[model samples]
Target: MTPKAARRTVRIAMNGVTGRMGYRQHLVRSLLALREEGGLDLGDGTVLWPEPVLVGRREPALRAIAERHGLAHWSTDLDAVLADDTVEIYFDAQVTSARQESLAKAIAAGKHVYTEKPTSTGLSGALELARLARDAGIKHGVVQDKLFLPGLLKLKRLVDGGFFGRILSVRGEFGYWVFEGDWQSAQRPSWNYRAEDGGGIVVDMFPHWEYVLHELFGRVTSVQALATTHVPQRWDEGGKPYDATADDAAYGIFQLEGGAVAQINSSWAVRVHRDELVEFQVDGTEGSAVAGLRTCRAQHRAATPKPVWNPDLPATESFREQWQEVPDNTAFDNGFKAQWELFLRHVALDTPYRWDLLAGARGVQLAELGLRSSAEGRRIEVPEIAL
Candidate 1:
């Protein structure tokens, strides 16, 4: 008879579970779902189990989540939780403003840290965090969930297969109309519109674009951006009007290291007209692909359509139908959950994980430079960051 695999539980102290992203994606979909799936098997003689200890500022919210998930641990005191030697990992999903300080404390406590981006409010702080983590010799990671998405995965597969030979340009559109709180409650928190609260489209989305463009195509070499506050006045959660001090929309053009150009528009004020809320169209010499959060469509040079340029004639070609849908050769798990598992494995097995604090710092650097570009009305060059 085969011997049973030994189970080792890893206690993770999760902070900011009360936030929308934290509650839905991290707590419920990722961690709890992993718990339900019998944790992660290390492929050795051990199974790594995750034990979540919910920590938040609000006692009621933490207690509620613990009760809902049947979790036995809940704490409002962060220092006390950090002092607990049993807790091996500290996962933070807090807002950008609070993230740096909390992560710093966690690092100081000598705990493995994982967090959402932008890791800090500015590039300097982010670099400092990376430096601190390196000095502490603790396993640290940032959530780069898009890389694990099915659409992006398929797009990556195409890139690896050399389908898009000598990629020329990439275009991306990401946003949806976030309702102003006047008639209906805002979809996002009230703080997202206030610049003082570390809210702005450039700060919020450029970090995302940084990782995506860099990982798939090449390193971003330079950036030219125009950031604007489209909705200057907005209603708060209390049905009171407030000035939207942050940029609600950003139009950016980035030059990649390999000579490819990438353009992306991030907005909170735009209405949805595309098939997906977010989509990227990559054009190459050999082929082209359009990838969204869950779907990817492609068109090869062989199947390229030719249309006559006659302004007098009505359009006849069904351009949307010309592209073929990319097939999913394998099942894909939830991106956030997939990342969580990988980070967990990295903690347990010292597996190769690239999306560390430095990568996250690069994202923050992009956002900072993008904002600076907009402010100075000139292109800003991206410099390599070293910890």
Candidate 2:
């Protein structure tokens, strides 16, 4: 709203803004915050304003979110919103099942597409959407927020600096116990436990792992996985017991394009005992580094202490103390907001973007392969997705 010199406004049809990820990360933290800062500077003195039009099914929730953010536009009718020529982009944050249908409609309606990951549960559906978007010749993107995370950024810096020398392996531990809704309200929605609603740990986390692994190291070539429903029964939001048909936990071993190996364990049934809810420890020839959500620590090979195999006896040395903490030399912005700005710039200034619909399809392919590996009880080779 600042009096800027000839700023252009990009009207974004933000579908599924009633959901948690959509509202908290996209609407509030990213879009509204950008608006509050007087929009984005395009580096040539002209600013790019992002005007988000909230679209959802529930009238009350949609009205509430829009009013709280002081947004002027919102509607329950998606078709009507898409019909408006002013709407340039359609962003989807809904369930995985709805991604293909919603995106196909948006692409057909001549609107650019942007969305959260796991574009579809099946590889075929995801590929179809990607091809559709490509055929439409409109701009598209998927949220790959982890790549812009501070801890991951620090790790990337170490890699770029050749601190790792030759990378060997990556071990990722991600999980936290979700409280059952019987005595305590569940943090996640009840539908997340149902397979019918396109909910599962492998589908959810594999998308993140795909981008993380691809961005940090290389492309994932194969996967060997075991997925299970740790907590089969849990109370729903309405205080009624429901069968948790979806897998709440997944253990995976991945083979990257390089000789390096990667293992990731994702679960919602386990308690947190490590440095953070999600942490990745990468080992290399020269050193090893462990990165959490906001921090990273590294230990050089020369500094590694020799430990005697005396597990039966009391420990003597502090293993964790050997690594030095990496300092925050620069302010880390919100990952989602940063990506949003980039996407805006991509739309406005025709900047290069890598996280397109094809990238999202790759995520879907990984999740599908992981599930297949679990079901078939074997390692599945990940083939390159071609249009």
Candidate 3:
């Protein structure tokens, strides 16, 4: 290791480390992986140094996580973690409804903050968090994991290189059936079915899509959406049936800043019948591409063809061979881990990270607009938030 690399270390306090996304994605998968992997290079001679000190719901779970990851510190008290001088950064993977309160406390403690998407359940809370972070003068970021995915990264390269002439529109299909807690012993957490816990596709997934769309295309101007709860009753943690107050699915159409339009379907009640769990098809005037979790394909207009759509016509010709698979050019790792490295670098070296709290608030704005559109039964224009 370089002498300079050895000098810098970023101490992180992970909040909600025992939860699903918290434990798997934020702690073990992202921060711990970085710690085990040594470090990540940002540019120049700077490298990100991640040191995780786990904080979670249960003491036993937190201890197990710490021991398993070879981390020395574990805490059940959020206040103590915030007060610890060694913890320079406070990372939140807490439930959506709890994020605002936790973030407010963390910011008050004068620590840099990073958290999972949707920052908070509503625009007001998200805006408040943004204001608090700004006032605290600490670095803040939200996970925009899709932008860092290898397949999507390749697509971004194509777009930036003008491989796709003038972008037209994007279509995204995201989701799969999450088993009911009672019948299958619960695939997802019970909190995910309760509205009070901030559980819903529109709130959870749109933040991710907003970043992806904004990164690949342009800003969203307006949105029209339809949302529903397919499963009315779901089992809770106690194995008792509770009303599923949150939406299980959301279908939305967005008008981007430019004339380009996009549509996205997010659901927890759908079956996967495609290449991957989530897939996106991006079409531009010059070419088109289809990107999945594991693969990406590009199509040039010159090599593409028009086909007649007839009920009697074979379904195979339309989409089967329209695009060519783009070879994977980078080593693969967890997307959350990749973003974690970036955030660490941003904190340690003042790296130019664009995925800040303002961007996160924009996502909350879209989700709020989607809910408003669904509620009012009319298309709603998304208002811009000052970054």
TM-score of each model, paired residue for residue = 0.99, 0.98, 0.94
Compared with the true structure, what per-residue lDDT tens digits does model 1 show for residues 1-387?
989989999999999999999989998999889878887889898888889999999999898888887999989999999999999999998878999999999999999999999999999999999999999999999999999999999999999899999999999999999998998889998889999999998998999999998899999999999999988999998899999999999999999999999999999999999999999999999999999999999999999999789999899999999999999999999999999989999999999999999999999999999999999999999999998
Candidate 3 — which residues are off by over 4 angstroms? 1-7, 41-48, 313-318
Q: Which of 1 and 3 is the better model by TM-score? A: 1
Q: lDDT of all predictions, in order shown?
A: 0.94, 0.92, 0.85
Local distance difference test, candidate 2: 0.92
Candidates by TM-score, descending order = 1, 2, 3
Model 1 CA deviation exceeding 4 Å by range: none
Clashes of each: 0, 0, 0
Best by TM-score: 1
Candidate 3 C-alpha error for residue 259, in Å: 0.5
lDDT of 3 by residue, 159-193 (tens): 88898898899999999989888768877887787
Worst 10 residues of 2 by lDDT: 1-10
What range of 10 consecutive residues in model 1 has the weakest lDDT sum? Answer: 31-40
